[model samples]
Target: MSGNSAERAGELEVVLVKAGRTKIRYRSELLLDDGNHVAVRAPWAGEGVRDFGFVRFEPGDVFTEHYWRDRWYAVKEVRAGDGTLKGWYCDVTRPAVRDGAELVVEDLDLDLWRSADGTEVLRLDEDEFAESGLAERDPEGATAAVAALDELEKQARAEGGLTALLA
Candidate 1:
């Protein structure tokens, strides 16, 4: 689903992975294109750390570049404990300028997957995910999370097209 700016802002669910010595902890704060509010911070770090949530890499762990924005942003690829290559953790770049930043809504989507049966969606809903566990690579969550995503889409559209959130 697209849009969902303010909702995304309120719906922000961060999964903090405390990396071991070799593993690097990457704390990603995905915002819904909030004007001048889209920022990425360091793990346990307060105040002006670069928006790109880059952490020290641990041995045997791989962080690859995925989606790129302009000549700067590059989405980080995170590999979970299950050997699954998950999507970006934090991607930082100059957001697309819509109406000179007013009425601009950048889609902030945190995608999770569901099982082939689809019943799994309900088990790992948003709140559960917020407390239970993290979303695997390309894998859908329980019904509730999926429902929230659906609602988020509707809400996103109602806000002001896609650019409104960014604005």
Candidate 2:
């Protein structure tokens, strides 16, 4: 989290938090950090193939993730090891916080996914979001999370979809 440009290129520890606890954390190569937006690249952190029926995340898959301090979501561009485009996996979360070498993001439990071909745009994990009782506990955060999910879905269905947002 240095202001110096030359110090930007290095390893960044990504901490994903859920329910006031750390969910998952991994190291990623910090590609860009322009104050508001932070981008990092990392290989799939899961141990085995995760088949979601729509997409499979296995070894040799890379994820280029984008997080914003001013936004309530994070977008991840998934690609195969051979450089084939897969799709985008987006998470509805609280605005990201950069603490020294650690980038912390809180999972709001809502998610959206868009296929690379733009043939399928899915809203995922709404049940989990509701079950989390965010609305009862934190109404404002719950509202923001829903709004973020809506905005992401709209962008995913737009003409350029996620490509336009990533670009």
Candidate 3:
């Protein structure tokens, strides 16, 4: 699978480790080799920038257990940076609402897409998010952040950090 990844075109192969049933995290290496296959160039390069004919991850995203692997993502026409291509990260999660500084919210349901030039554009469900007044958080990041914060607070209290602060 990594062999064909555009992110692995001129560099190390993209390797994905399983995080859970829903998603697998992969580290994609990018190296610009114009004469070869993946033609990733710097963003500064103007019109000559490589053109991405198809965006695989953005549209037909499918999760599967392939080659006896746990779970994998199949993105077609995937391009990486330096090849003047952008990458996308897509997911759906809980929503965030803000009340005060106590709640530092972020977007949660952020489906990300990258152009060949490395511009990350988000894929969002407008109607769903708008209904929640998610001005402070996206469904993905905000939800994850809050959950992590909760854990942090718990650990801090366990370590007596909160009590120390009061002193």
C-alpha TM-score for every candidate: 0.21, 0.94, 0.23
**Per-residue lDDT of 114 in model 2:** 96
Q: Model 1 — TM-score against the truth?
A: 0.21
**Candidate 2 local lDDT, 37-113, one digit each (tens):** 99999999988899999999999999999999989999999999999999999999999999878899999999999
lDDT value for model 3: 0.29
Q: Is 1 or 2 the stronger prediction by lDDT?
A: 2
Query: For residues 1-167, could you state the per-residue lDDT of candidate 1 as single tens digits?
Result: 23355245432222222111211223334433344343332233223332322232333434332221221122334443344543233322223232321222122233332222222221112354444343453134334335545543443335342123223
lDDT order, best first, reads 2, 1, 3
Give per-model CA RMSD: 15.8, 2.5, 17.4
Error of 3 at 154 (Å): 26
For model 3, the superposed segments whose C-alpha errors exceed 4 Å read 1-86, 92-109, 130-142, 145-167
Ranking by TM-score: 2, 3, 1
Best by TM-score: 2
Among residues 3 or more apart in sequence or in different chains, the pairs in candidate 2 whose N, CA or C atoms overlap within 3 Å are none
